[model samples]
Target: MAARMKRRDFIRRTALVGAGLLILRDPKSAWSYQANNRLNIAAIGAGGQGGGLVNIFAGMGENIVALCDVDDRRAAETYKRFPNAKRYKDFRRMLDELANSIDAVTVATPDHTHAVASIAAMKLGKHVYCEKPLTWCIGEARAMRKAAIEHKVITQMGNQGTASDGLRQGVEIVRAGVLGQVREVHVWSNRPVWPQGVDRPKDTPPIPPDLDWDLWLGPAPYRPYHPAYLPFVWRGWCDFGTGALGDMGCHTLNLPVMALKLHRAIAEGKTVVVEAEHSGCNGESYPKWSIVRYHFPARAGMAPLTLVWYDGGKKPPQEVLSLIPGEVPGSGCLIVGEKGMLYAPGDYATRWQLLPADQFRDFRPPAPFLPRSPGHHREWVLACKGENITPMSNFVDYAAYLTEIVLLGNLAIRLGGRIEWDAATARVRGRPEAEPLVHRPYRKGWTL
Candidate 1:
């Protein structure tokens, strides 16, 4: 076998090689078994969400040639599913060994590890589909965006709602002025169940034989293995996860960002200013509840809008919930506008209907359209073959959408005040004390 290649060097060559080779090929024909069309895929962080991604992609006829994860046991079952694929504990080693073969990579790791793994993969000229929130901090988010641009790799974030027909139509309706002048929007979810804001767990579990605890911790501080932090419950912790906002805000709260075209309003002071209020553990150790209010000057055609996010089993109110058909708001968003109201109390993939027909009969409910891509995983699988269409949750878009909500909310939770934000620069312009907390430091030997 040939000697392994460094990620940076591999990417530089791959970009020149892959672009020239892929540019002439038709994406529609790339999925077939033709010698020039087969795609080789690799997966990093094959545990909970990562394992699911592997399954989704493996079933899509792509060649899943590598699997990397810190835990052998959790990855064991996933590896068996792709028995022909090579497995490794570290993604860097996997990339080095499989550099020539891997055309794309899926990073389904924790929040803190997202940027590290994604940037490394993107640098190798491998198309990447990283999980939601993209990165733990705003700086990492920016870094990943830059790396993706520099490497010219197709990238997607795991905010699956973006691929949903309901969300697309909802956004279309909002853009078309059907929900005229959306002034106040409420986006929410049931999250932070991993027990944030509470003290660390008392019982430390011994590292399992099939697990590499140190590697799993990666850039996080040295903490003994605990059951509470593993097997899919890390969403609430500050160290490893990004709480509810980081967990679901990108999915649930994405509607307003897309519908209002908030990105275009940066020069007009029409930016996201989050007012975070009351954060602490619920029953278990979890910063389970946060009421974040996002104020935005309306995009040119609409009125100023205030977007509120509620998570951790918290409901907006009976009056607000009553606006929709069902008593339970569950895990979705409510858009309140001047002429009418629309309540979609669930994921965009599923049922999301406009409230009471009596409100606006002429207002035909928008068509619920499925995405052109096949789910989130396959979207990236297909994108690697020079197809420009990625999951609606592309990192450049999602990182901008998510980091603003999660990091700014975190600043409010930390500073205990509503800080005004300058979206152009992504900083709190008016407050001096709140400026330093904009980004957090990694433990060591790790960088955004």
Candidate 2:
């Protein structure tokens, strides 16, 4: 038999062909795939949320060409379901071996690893769908956005709520001035169900044979294997996860961010000041309970706004909670406007009501301006198939901006002072000490 071609050589030889096939194809005919025009897709972190994503895309008829996970135990079911698909513990090896074959990739890795996996795929001109809040730090978020644009790949963040008609309608109403000059917003979550605000565990257990402990660590600093940080409890840890704000902010803050056009405001040189008061952080993990406030200057012909985020059972003042009929939701968002408040009483912002029901009992929503999404994952897949469409949470258009804003709050929490953000330069003013946290150092062999 002839020798097999090396992965690097194959990638270099077919780079242009791959780019032309995926990126420079005829736009009008991109989405014209027949019922059986299945895409060859791969998934990273194929367990937990990743497993659900694998099933969803597979259910949509795409081919599961390959799957990668650091923990084989967690990904056993997915592996069993797609036995024909190749498997690997290291994503780098998978991408190397299948570089020219994958049409798209879905990333459900831990927060710290998101940028590395997604950027690697995008650099090869593959479309990507990544879980929120997009990246572990502000710098990675920016880099992901830039890579998506440079590679000209279709991209979407897995906020999921962006696909809801109710969420879209709420965004339209708020933008159409139905909320009447909103200036205050409150978003809360019942999170940190995992342990936080505590010191790191001292015991170092033997690494599980089913787990590649170093690969699982990825870009995070060296830490011994521990059950305390795995199997769905890493969100509260600062090193591996992004805490509650990073976990839930992408979903809870989606509507308000879109409604207020905050992204555009930030782009146009407006200052976004952020500060936080928490239950006290020990530096190893996020605080158990905390509230963060972001102040945005008036922009785009709108009033200045204050967005306060609460987590760990803390909530807005009772006066704000009184607007709801019953007890305030364990997690919700309330936008206080001059005329009335727009209350979305859940994490997804899927259902919302105008507060002071008596005053707006006869109110009517403005005509819809935003086009509705064909399911969120479907949106990304269709776009990847060359549809003349853009996913609602496309990295270039929305996700990156949203992630940047959400992660900035973490900076405030870490530095224990107000963050005067200069969006143009992506820096915190007068806080050189906080700059390292904005873009953290990675272990050797990792590059964004």
Candidate 3:
């Protein structure tokens, strides 16, 4: 296997919890490695971003016990880096065989498989660090939060910006009324830097011998193997990926969503209106460009907000960009409050500026109330070791709900129209046709 390998590398509609917030820290895990203040970690997808995650965890001095990936070529780099780690073509097998040896797992798989893998690990009491836009569908997002809460496990979603001091400060600044009564938020992304706005290719190319075709299509309904769907291009595919909004919404919208308490607002209204306008729509892929609008009712002593998301060559109006000086960046967020807007000029929201530079020339940001992160992944590792620190993007408090909100845009895109979401029931309001997109049907072997 080493010689052949290339180099370098869920639908359960449960009652959605309202504002899924629970205790952030619990030193209750009984993993055997706890005695030594280390965790036996497993990487479910150890190549590309996944490989990067494995490298980070390993560098944190945790044990990398096993590795799983469907494509050997994609995983070659991780294999070279951790030759001793047991390898498997499927995560289910890896978890079953090494469950006892593993104390925690990091799931860097595609968005579709996130909930299943993370839930499976959590069911066995394994701490999990899954990548962002937590799950493919809203129901799965709800299930993820419920599972994490039930297991009482440490969990963090991989939106690295949540750990940045600047983002934390931005959140604090908004909450402190520095951006008083933020009623409008405009966020745009330079994404779908992948294939999109097209029908599925008719050709059935031979699956590479290095790839386990069936395993790679986990949970999602089966489709003929195509190169356009793999090696990171999957972001544009309707069946497998969540499109540009899903790809970048979690990051670009992170600041406004957190600062404005958008997730919590979902619980306040089942009629939260979501609508989208795009270049075009298709059954198999996302549009080339899209503008998704979400209507959020008043919550947390804040006013109502209409958060607008743009991607695939779309951006906020020139009026919104006028506040920021110089050339418009490819991706950024603008939070428009009564006082002034706070502009965070990157995906992570790690750097932000209060707009109308002259208005607050001497404006002072509020003192930080939120605890600083030890670094994105480090928070998870520390929490796994029973440290006092808790990751900001833990599934219970943040990730799952944020993911649900982000994926809602896809539902609107799928319908090419507005849909009201009933957060309480975990379904779309009076839209049975939209139900499938909320809780998707999986292939025979897959179970959510």
Candidate 4:
């Protein structure tokens, strides 16, 4: 006689047996079984980057069940593609009405609305895939991490490079101590391809007929509709987006952040001081060019380090760029270590090389430590299905902490001085007046 299984194991085995029986009875039923397993996914902000995400997930075999966007005109292509999916202008209404139907949601709205939408979905027990910087401010990032923990839902931040094997290898190499006792990191970006350091547009254009202006302003203070803030120029604005650092830092900083374990250090109550020197910020948009520096104390047996960020056509000093073999790319990350330097060119850190090539021509990278991702979207989808896999950019593990660090640069930009940070208390020491910028006031009817 077969050994009796525990009740829990028996029930699980019985369910698997029943499912196998269905598959064996009819060949076509196997396909139907797959269809049933697909997640009922919804998308908020179904235009621009959101539309691209909707199609990617749908192509991956998830059922697109709903789409919400404030501008009908901008989302027309996606609407036409997923006509079967229910549509709405407001995410709040869509989530309320389809609370029972949605298994997961993808939030690709403006940075300011990311936390609100994601928190709402997580609260309803729906899995969430949110685009990066994850949140517009430090407080929202903390709230997002908390909500994900409290609700026990699958969550991924859309730092797609986290899926790259090259990036993972780079991270492994860094942590393996190839560059012994690293002390400095410099990251640069050529952003603000849009305008910055400028006054708000004086023209208040007529709100487009297909656009819901009130819904577009969700959680942000009221401002008249202007074309300048639409169709992707919002990155430069203070209220709607996180400017260049918030825009590209997640991608550029991912490699170093993962390898150095900076997030874990911050969580363990390490001191981080932030200061900035910029061309000049007018409180309306980011400066045309600026550099921000972060000072981190020693943690986890690693030496203390300084991270410097540049954006809006700014870059590391020429003496630093000379370390590279040829002309430096428009965007890149350079880590200076005591033994050698690791230079990764491009926003994703997908490709890299050790500097002073002759010194380490035959350097072999360490064996891979991080589990290779199947793909960024697939990782999240599989996690949502209760698979054992964990997405690398999940809110609690990575994105929230990254967002907090990225936004700290913004706070320094606004305050125009070095601000001592207390990570445990989430306070700016000796600058109570700057506290409000850490957590901005949301407009009426929205809460995180």
Candidate 5:
């Protein structure tokens, strides 16, 4: 009888494939998870990066139950490909009607809408995979973390490198103290790849018929429809996006945060200091170039350190560059420690090298401690089915704080002054002017 019961359980675990999508059966369904029998996935902002994400999930054999986007022209291909999937222009309506059917949602919307779309899904207990720099502002990042935890939902921020073996290994190495007291970190990006330091266009362009301009401007203040903010260029605008620091900081800064426990300051009720200097700020968009500094308070036995971020063709000083050999990459991270420096020569912390080769020629890496991921999206998919694995970049554990640290730099940049961040209170010390930036007022129709 025991043997027979075991066989039944094994067969019950078999995945169900419907419409060519896999619905991996689970031992138990948790957190309002409905995908144990049939995984029905939804994509918000289904065009460009959003479209690409839907395609990847589809390739994983997950049913695309719904696709939501504000622009019809941009999402044309996605709608055509997933004709069977219900389509909508507003994500709120999509979540309202299809909440029961969708087991998970992928939020690839522009930076500003990330918090709203993701928080709404989490409130309904649907698993969420949101794009990087989790939200447009620091308040939203905190809210995203709260929603994920309160709902007991599975969450993965879309910094895919969080799953890579190299990144995980790097984190483990740093935690193992192989680098011997990492004191300073420098992360640089070649962003603003679209455009920055430009005034808002004066000409009012016709809102494309396929686009719902109101929906596109969701939480942001009202603005006439303009071509400049559409498709992919929203990263530079103050109202629409979070610029270079928000665009790439989440990816480039992941290693240092995880390894050095940069979140320790906040966790321990400490404040972080941040300041920025930039090239020509026009008050409409981010500067063409900027350098920002973050001072984290010492906590959890780790010494205090400062992280410097450079963007818009900015690179680190030559003295710092001299530590690594050969051609310096366009974007990379450097962690300076008492013993030696560790360099990650890419946007994602997918690869690393112990610098000054001769000094470290005999060094052997510490044994890996962090569990290696089974692909980024797969980790989320598995967790959605109540699998034992959790995504490394899950909101409650990692992404929220990482995003908070990243957005703080932008606050300093836009405010053009030093910010004494009171993490415990989530306020700028003696800077009432930053209230608008910290806690943004939503339009009447929107809510986070």
Candidate 6:
């Protein structure tokens, strides 16, 4: 027999055990700050990216209240993962049924559906985390931004790379003038592969038993069923997806855009557009070699700089590569400044490196002074629970990012000429003919 422990000692030991449990189970505890509460999360488009996000939130102890998708096969898979979660083929129905139960929503849908689904969530006061490219068109991006602000709901864009500690650290270093006054930026990507520049499908394949064909094409034009358009091959098409610029431009070009805060520097009421050459794409609606050019306003104590976006799978010229070693580091950025240059890998997750052999061969980055951020989904949930602003690719940032890149590529696609863009008015200045392309009218039953 052993003597009974005193009440105070027992209480202290119990608390210590509880603390250990919290430390091991809750990764958010590792951070100095977190929302005092958990978020009730719902996912729209329960497929690849969306599924990954759901798993992260669920692991963090958030209630997965809803799962939405158009494809039956996709929905069935999602249902199996979180059987208790309410499932719906249409997002609108999910929002209607679970509006009161959901505190936030993660939207991972095709470019065409991003705006509609996200706008709906925001209007209902749900914090929204939408996938990259933001929207199918520049107009939709603008509208989504407006809706998010109007509803006073927290919002994030699903550019996961932004959440990486490496990304933010890189941004701070560049902003600190470690790389000097920057001017030109070169961003490249390998994308734009699929059924581009080809004749419309002449054969109508039988609709699969598990797919809701009409629902998948919602908002986008109604077309006969085709296997080429299904599964993951939609990226290359015009009506359903945003081509390569829309697909990879947001992710590849994000660093330069945010590091410089080019969006914030641009005049709120003014728009700048420059004429550019376009080719490539093998006849797809978007060009394979479309070079996007934008004149960004001066900021961070530097003069105005021209930002050029390269797509159609083209590599930067040798002159640009000369500043860096080993062939421009493949998919990365070349930032040429007055004093020095900076080179960052194209993969947004990679860290930024100073260019040229002469600059600090032995120099080391400053001590890791920043707190290690949790994965993307957790950041949004934590941000939503408190008054803190979610820093990752939120709707506002992604809206500006997508509007510029998507419109740039869209201007390239319009065969008439290199149309001028007005960021302020959200229109194409010198070309009234291009205005129609700026805003796409949705098919019936879709509301913005």
Give the top-scoring candidate (lDDT): 2
Query: Lowest summed lDDT over 10 consecutive residues: which window, candidate 5?
Result: 1-10
lDDT of each: 0.68, 0.84, 0.82, 0.83, 0.83, 0.67
TM, every model:
0.85, 0.93, 0.93, 0.92, 0.92, 0.85
* Prediction 5 global C-alpha lDDT: 0.83
For candidate 3, list the clashing residue pairs, or say none.
Answer: 8-77, 9-77
Residue 102 local lDDT, model 2: 82
Residues 301-353, candidate 1, lDDT per residue (tens digit)? 66777888787677787778777764674687788877676677674533466
Residue 284, model 3: lDDT of 88
lDDT of 6 by residue, 338-358 (tens): 666767776674577776657
- Which ranges of candidate 2 are over 4 A from the true structure? 1-32
Select the stronger candidate by lDDT from 3 and 4: 4
**Residue 435 error, candidate 6, Å:** 2.1
lDDT of 3 by residue, 279-392 (tens): 888778999999999998887788988999999878888777777887878889889999888888879998988888899899888777777778999888776665555677
Residue-by-residue lDDT tens digits, candidate 4, 1-448:
0011111111111121110111011111011123246878899989999999999999998889999999999999999999999999989899999987887899999998998999999898778999999998898999998888777677899999989998988888788889999889999998878888989889888999999988888888999999888778888898889898989999998888877877766677666899999989998888898899999888766789999999988899889998999889899999999999999999999889997899889988877767788999998887676554667888876788888888889999989889888889898888888777888788988887
Q: CA lDDT of 326 in candidate 4?
A: 88
The TM-score of candidate 4 is 0.92
Give the poorly placed runs of model 3, Cα more than 4 Å off. Answer: 1-22, 25-27, 30-36, 268-270
**For every model in order, what is the number of clashing pairs?**
5, 2, 2, 0, 0, 10
Q: How close is candidate 5 to the true structure, as a TM-score?
A: 0.92
lDDT string for model 2 (85-170, tens) is: 89999999999999878878899999999999999998887789999989999899889988887776778899999899999889
Q: Which stretches of candidate 5 lie over 4 Å from their true place?
A: 1-36
